[model samples]
Target: MSLALEFVSTVRADRSGPVDTLADVDGLTSWARAHAAGPGFTASEEARQETVRLRQAVRALFARAVAPEPPSRADLPDLPPFKEALALVNATALAAPTAPQLSWDDKPVLVIAPAAETDEPTRLRARLATAAVEFLAGPEVALLRTCPAPRCVLYFVKEHPRQEWCSTACGNRARAARHYREHKK
Candidate 1:
């Protein structure tokens, strides 16, 4: 899966509320390790906080993008979190030495590899941020969708024509709700 999608999947469903995977530094570290293709990332308290902030900003941006209408300039300015997240993403990309390199392999023919620098945490963030920017700016932004299941806060890219839910469980839940409503009547 793309980094943007993986980052968005850090949140899960709950009976009471949404469950955030990056609720702490350890969760953030686990997520980084799983998604990051580069060097081993050392998660710090600061990095975890920044990741949480960025996640919220990205969620807000996704919500706006999937809305029925565009937000006004006044509305945009009020989103200080989004602004700060964008700054961090831009700065990290600018500070990076070089983009990931491609190398030829006997089995796969070609492979893209990350830089061999020690700054794993920064690289991971930059890569994820870049993916998010690309996803939001590209034409596929239209595919960005939130799950329709009740109490579900997850987001997903619509990969198939009939794909309406994020997972089979969500689809089942929607079906069950529809059935209950019909039977109650």
Candidate 2:
């Protein structure tokens, strides 16, 4: 999975409640360490708050994409934060030095390696923004769907043709709900 997809999954929903992995400074730090490979990513209260805001904006954009009615240009979700994040990512990419190096093996293999930079958080954010834009603009946008299970608020990229819910647990919940509805009738 791409880092951007993993970032989106950080905000998960369960029966207890929605778990925002980026809720606090510590959480943000932990997430950055795990996903962004940035053990030294700065974690401040302001950063946590900014992450939350960006998460919400990203979620809103997904919601609009998967909505039943195609949103008009005026009705499209505003993505100022995503734009900012993308800019940061673009700047980082532009600054990165990519050079091909030959491996010291009997069979030589060439690889393009990017220079190491310390801007971890910005890189992660840029990855996420780029991914979101790609997902929205790509043909797979049709496969993007919100979970239909009761109380399930997660979004998933549908893999199977018959897959409806986000997971088997959600599928069971939806089936149980349908059975209960039938019994009630």
The digit string of per-residue lDDT tens for model 1 on 1-185 reads 56777786777667776677888877888778777643366688887876766665666676677787332221234244656656765665554445445565655344444454636666666677777888889988898777878767677778999998878999999999999999995
The models' CA-based lDDT, in order, is 0.69, 0.65
For candidate 1, which ten residues in a row score worst on lDDT?
A: 69-78
Model 2: number of backbone collisions: 0
- What would the per-residue lDDT of candidate 2 be over residues 1-185, giving only the tens digit for each residue? 55555666677766786677887888998888877645667777876665665565566666667778332222124334545645543453454344678887789999855445535554555455556666767877788877778776667778899998779999999999999999995
Candidate achieving the largest TM-score: 1
Candidate 2: Cα lDDT at 98: 49
Number of clashes recorded per candidate: 0, 0
The lDDT leader among the candidates is 1
